[model samples]
Target: MTGENVNDTTGDMLRVEDLSVEFRTANGVTRVVDSIDFAVPRGGALGIVGESGSGKSMTSLAIMGLLPKGGTATGSIRFDGKDLLSERESAMRRIRGDRIAMIFQDPLSSLNPYYTVGVQIAEAYRSHRSGVSARAAKKVAVEAMDRVHIHDAARRADHYPHQFSGGMRQRIMIAMALSMEPDLIIADEPTTALDVTVQAQILALLAEIRRDTGAGLILITHDLAVVSEVADRIVVMRGGHLVEKGSVEDVFSDPQHEYTRRLLDAVPRIDDEIGELRTTAIPVVAEEEKR
Candidate 1:
């Protein structure tokens, strides 16, 4: 597939071209993410789907400049016409939680146990905006919690993260991300630790937030069904290489690559006729822009 795009800037929020990530080890240099290309358009959502160790998370980390100590990324990662790969660490720090926020897989590990939830959220807000008093920051934190539909947000703000349930903790993480009013959000397995019902709720919340803020979204996950309704486009990866990329409808209905067809077959369906699983590739018509 081609990796070209239009010159217009209507929805070109994040563009990743020929991106590759490598790690140096005692054995030798190992490449975790091969040369890959994709883009998340303005106000649009893109999902990266594959099994474990497929480099989906690594791709997200590369874009955020949060790769492991030994990992290094090559190629271009442009956000709003600025190449993040070329920016200094200090400059990247300014952009990380301010212009581009992230929602991690687990909130418990990400949140601090020593501080109150409200204080943590307030600190994240005040760090980006200077000359903000504690009272105002706390007010912002409470409002953010309320926006996420947290019950008694003012009271819960004073409580520790351990006091809340897993679902509520995730909402708190979302509140922290919303406090920054970022232009793009990279959510890595946001609903992994939650139950099925909670997973649906979190996904719905993410969709609503995207609708309200018009922020570009990059959802990194291993489940194909998890991102089916949330993402506008889908990119299938295998062994660090992009096996198929297309609109969500196109990829789900008619996968072009053999690897992609295999993934679809692995998903359990309720309406399936009790028979053997098919592994044949379906016809896929390539669109003009294969972002």
Candidate 2:
């Protein structure tokens, strides 16, 4: 986590202001994102939530400077006071994988089955800092695995992507992201492919990492239940536009908009729903007795 490494996970991180991305399609021009503004403080977590096609992923990819071809991005992404949108490709190379890192949802697609997991994680750390030996890099990979709560770090390090389960592969992806210790981590639906319990574990790992390194975190997910446990604040997007933004409690307990209300209503609460059923059943029993 040396300051020079860009993986220091320190300092005020990313600020995205008035960000927009548009694509020229055969039909016409489509504005996928429009003037979205959000700032991730030095040590905080922000969750971006919306249904599919809300442009949450594109916003993060824009921040990472990884937008696909034919998409024109406007506005500014300022990270550590450096203008990301205007930065040269060479300068962006330094920041893209080092200062700011990302973890995608599908590890199967991200990690190469041919390469060993340890090699991939080490390459990420080695890419930023020079003169690092393979042994040291491998140790960092193992330690990252341990940090993420992966059992048998050394054994798991040697395993290929196909060897590990879905949850394990996702952990391996997370290990790679944290191995470099980036200052800001943008996780795009990191747990989307995992089961409920595994998703909880991954979120907990992310919470632990943010606490340990004090890095700004932008967790992109449509699952409000997942974000509720970890995010300090939440941003809601709809139809490529900003819909609602507020603290978790504010949005959950006192949603100010109809869309937010519907989103919350869509979440299935086991205890509350069961209690309602039981309470209604008691009235049914009483009515039967009266009959």
Candidate 3:
């Protein structure tokens, strides 16, 4: 999958145009992310929100050039003034962890159980930086762990992924991403596996990392509240289509689509009437999108 060159910097860190992802199966080609377009300016945050099977993760994977087998992505993904989709696999390999980093939802699954946390982080750092010795890389790994507020990072770095709690493992993943000091960070449902308190902590930590490093952030999730908490702008997707997008205040206060309204209405509120009836009906707009 490749795209034509479009040299439009204009202060944007990442620019995507008519991006689409499809998977070819035994039956036929199924589009998972359809003609979506958005931008993340340098040091800015963009949130992609939607329900399950909405192609939020697929969009991120397409940008990373990590699509699964039989999956193909078309259209333009411009990153830092270069067309990512046009780059060769080797070029993408250099850019992936060095210029762009990703934080997946499940750290346990993402991290290798056979390796120590320190070694994994060190290898990730050393992979992009040539001529870095193992000792130096280990030091960098410990420092990265410390940066994420991992307690006793130097000691914990020697432990395997299973030795850490779910939240701790997630922090380790964040530390690994930060070790590269990438210009862009794409977090896909980063808080999905944690408790509410830990989720808030992780979000705050991510916000702090962005603020401190001035890296562009793309957060993908289904929770509108989570996006509202951290994202400066939001794009709402449904059934692989981009339904609406705007500033946090704009979209939340004045949703222009029925699907967006239904999503907002479905959120449980603390001050609701006792035993108040809640509607479980899917909106007509959403139903049409499914079809």
TM per candidate comes to 0.89, 0.87, 0.89
| Residues 152-199 of candidate 3: C-alpha lDDT, one tens digit per residue | 999999999999989899999999999998888999999877877788
Tens digits of per-residue lDDT for model 1, 1-291: 111221224767899999998887766677778889998887778999877677888899999899999989999999989999999999899999999999988999989999999999999999999999999999999999998889999999999999999999999999999999888889998887787678789889888788777777888876677778699899998777888999899998999988887777766651252211233323332212122
| Residue 223 in model 3: lDDT | 76
Model 2 deviation from the true structure expressed as Cα RMSD, one decimal place = 10.5
Sort every candidate by TM-score, greatest first.
3, 1, 2
CA error at residue 67 for candidate 1, angstroms: 0.8
Better of 2 and 3 by TM-score: 3
Pairs in steric clash, model 3: none
Q: Candidate 2 lDDT, tens digit per residue, 1-291?
A: 322332233554677899988877666667888889887777678999877677899999898888888877899899889889998888888887787888998999988878899888988789887999999999999999998888899888888899988888888888888887787889999887777778788899888888787677899987777779789889988777788898898999999988777777766662244211122111111001111
lDDT of 1: 0.84
Q: Comparing 1 and 2 by lDDT, which wins?
A: 1
lDDT of each: 0.84, 0.80, 0.85
Comparing 1 and 3 on lDDT, the stronger one? 3
| lDDT, model 1, position 136 | 99
